[model samples]
Target: MLKHDYKVRTGNNQYEGFLVDLIKEVANMLNFQYDIYLVHDGKFGSKKADGNWNGMIGELISGNATLALGLLSITSQREEAVDFTKPFMIRYITVLMKVTKSTTSYFEFLNPLHPFVWFCTIGALLFVIIVLYVLERIGNINRTDYPSISFKECFWFVFGSLLHGSTDASPSTLSGRILTASWWFFALILILSYTANLTAFLSVKTINTPIKTVTDLASQTRIKYGTVKSSGTSGFLKNTDIEHFAKMWAQMSEIEPSSMVDTSEVGFKKVKEGNYAFIWDTTVNKYKTIEDCDLMEIGPPFDPQGLGISVPTGATYTEEFSMAILKLNDTGRISEMERKWWVHRNCPDYSNPSTDKTSGLQIENVAGVFFILVGGVAIAAVLCLGDYIAKRILKSVKKEKVHAISPEGDDI
Candidate 1:
C-alpha cells in the first residue's frame, strides 16, 4: 500500500554494509516497494538543508517518511518529533570505573544488596514461592471436594496442564482419573525433554578456563580499556580526569599506548596491547573500528537498556506498528529474533538454544513454578492425611470408653 524509502543517519561508515543487508531483509518482507537513502555524514534525510537538527525536525513536521529507523535514543526532543516503536533491544549502560575504584571510590556496586540485584533476586524468589503455594494446594485435595478447593488450585491446574495430567485433585473421582490419564503423555514428554536439556546445559566437570572479572584488568602491570568517544560511560570521562593526569605527572609513570590513542583508534589499538579491554556493543560492530579488536563486553551489560524505532508524530501508523510488535511478542517471534540476534551468540549457551532455546526455557521456567506449587499442595495433603488417621484412632478409643461407662452404669 506504501512506497518504502529509508531516511537514515549514523556517524559511522562501517555500518553501511550491515544496514544494507538489514534493509534488504526488511524490503523482502515488506509488501511495499522501497528505496534506500543513505545519509552517510550523520544527516537525517534529503529534507535537511545541511543535515542539521532544524532540517530533521522540519522533515518530520512536514511528513517526509512513514517510519524512520536509526541508532537514535528516545529522548524528549525525539519523542516530540516522532512516535517510537517499542524498543526491541534493551541496552545496559555502565560506569567504566577502574578496577582500583572499588577501593578508592565510595560507590558500593559489588554488594549483592544493590537495588537492581535485589529486583532480580526477589523476582526469582517470588516465582518459587508462588509455585510452591500452588503445588501444596493441589497435593492436598480429595476427589469429592475438588470443586470447593481454593482458587490457589489454579496454580496446580497449570502444573497439571504442563505435565499433561488431570487438573482435578480428587483422586477417587473417575473424571479426575480420566483427565490425569489423558494428560500423562504430554506431561511426560515436556518433563523428560526439559530434564535432558537442563542436564546437558548445567553439567560442568572441569573449570578449564578461569573466569575473569572487570577488576582484574587494573591489577595487570599493563591495563588499557577502550570505550567509544562521547559515550555515556563515566569511566571514560574519568580516564581523562585531571586527577589521573596528576597521578601520571607525580609518579613519573610511563605512557601507556592506550593513554596516547584517540577514541577512533582505541578499538584498533587495545586488543593488540595485552592486558587491555575494549568496551563496545555488538551494535557498534555495525561500524568498522571494532572489526579487529577481540572485544568482550567487560561483563554482561553493566546495565541493560533498549533502542527503538520512531514514526512521525500523530502518524496513524504509530498504533498499527505498536500493535504489530505486540502481536509478534504474543506469538513468541520477538523472543525468537532476540535469541537469534542477541542471546545465541552473546550469552552463555542455553539448552537447545540454537533452534528455540528461549521458548523452551520460558516454558520450563513456567512449568517449574507450577510444579513447585503442586509439591506444596502434596506436602499439605500428607499433613491432612496424618490428622485424619489420628481422628479415626481417637474415635475408636472414645467408643470403647463409652461402652465401658454404659456397663458400669448398668451394674450400679
Candidate 2:
C-alpha cells in the first residue's frame, strides 16, 4: 500500500513489493526498460490551494515519472490532472486509535441514572411527602389517636418508607392509609427500576471513550484527530460536504500547526500518546494494528476508494498498464503477493476473537459513596459544635439576667 513501506532488496540494491513486481511484469510484457523510485517528497499528492500538486501525482503531472504506483487512490480530482489505470486494489478510510483500558470511576453508581432522572426522582419523593402530609392532616382533624404530624415527622416518614424502614407513625383514617399505600407501591417500583439499572451499570467495566464514530470524533474537543497531510484521506476530509467531515476539516485547518501529519508513523505515534486519533487507509491500519498490540481500529471504514497507477494526462502506457494489472488479478498473482506481504508477516494474530467477561466490583466503584458519607459526618460534627456553643452562650446570658434581677447573687 502507499502507506506501507513494504520493500525487498535485490542483488543490485533495487527495492520490490506488489507494485514493484507488477511493474516488472508489465515492463517485461511490453519489452520496455523502466526505472522505479519513490516520490520526491514521499507523499501521495494533494492539490495545494495554489492549484498545484505535491507527491507522486505531482511527479507524474510534471513528467518526472512515466508511471506512478503504490496505493495511488483514483479520485475524480486526480483524474482531472492525470490518467489512471484500472484500480488494482480497493480500500477505505478508517480510524486507528490506541486501545484504552476499561475503567470504573468512583462515581460509577451515578452512571445508571442520568442526572435529570436522579433529580426527578428526588422531586417525586418530595412531592409524595407533601401530598401525604396534607392528606393526613385533613383526615386526622378530629381524631385524637393520631396527633398532628409536623414537617420533620412527615420527612422522616417518607424517607423511612422509601428505604423499606419502619416508622412509628401510622395513619388512623382510611383515606390516610390509602395515600400511604399508594406511595409505598410507587416507591417499590422506583426501587426495583433503580436496582436493576444500577446492577447492570456497576457489573460492566465501561470503556471510557468519547469517540466511537467519525461524528463522535468531530463533535468532541478532547481528542485531537487527523490524517496524513497531503494524502487521499486528508483530501477526502477537506473536500467532503458531509456535516461531520466538514466540521472536522474546519477544525483541523483552523488549528495552528495543523492536526495533519506528514506520515502514518507520526500520526500513529500521536495516538499512542493519548488524546489523539489517526485516520488513514483501512488496509494499512489493519496491518499496523495487527503488528502492534496497543493499537486498535475504532470503527468501520468511510469513503470507499480504490488504488491505481497514475500516468500523465495523455500518457500512452495507461491502456497497456491497465491490461497488465487486469491480467495479474485474473491470474490471482496480486492476491498471492498481498498474502505474502500483509498476512504472512511475523506479527501475532491480533485479530483473534475475544469473549466479554465480567469482573468483580472494585473499591473504586463505590469510593464516591464512602467519600460522601465521610463528608456528611464532618459537616454534622461542625453543626453539633455550633449548637453546643450557642447553648452555652444562652445559659451564660440567663445567669447574668438572674443575678442582675436578684437582691444578691442567689441560685436562680
lDDT of 1 by residue, 260-333 (tens): 33343455454444444554444543222223223333343443435565567777666655566666567776
- Per residue, candidate 2 scores C-alpha lDDT tens digits across 286-370 of 7777677777776657898988888999878789889988998999988987886677444332232243345688889989989
Once superposed on the true structure, which residue ranges of model 1 sit more than 4 Å away at CA? Answer: 1-31, 42-66, 76-81, 93-211, 215-221, 230-276, 282-295, 342-412
Q: Which residue pairs show backbone clashes in model 2?
A: none
Question: In model 2, which range of ten residues has the least summed lDDT?
Answer: 347-356
Clashes of each: 23, 0
Model 2 TM-score relative to the real fold: 0.57
Write down the lDDT that model 1 would get: 0.45
Q: For candidate 2, what is the total of clashing residue pairs?
A: 0
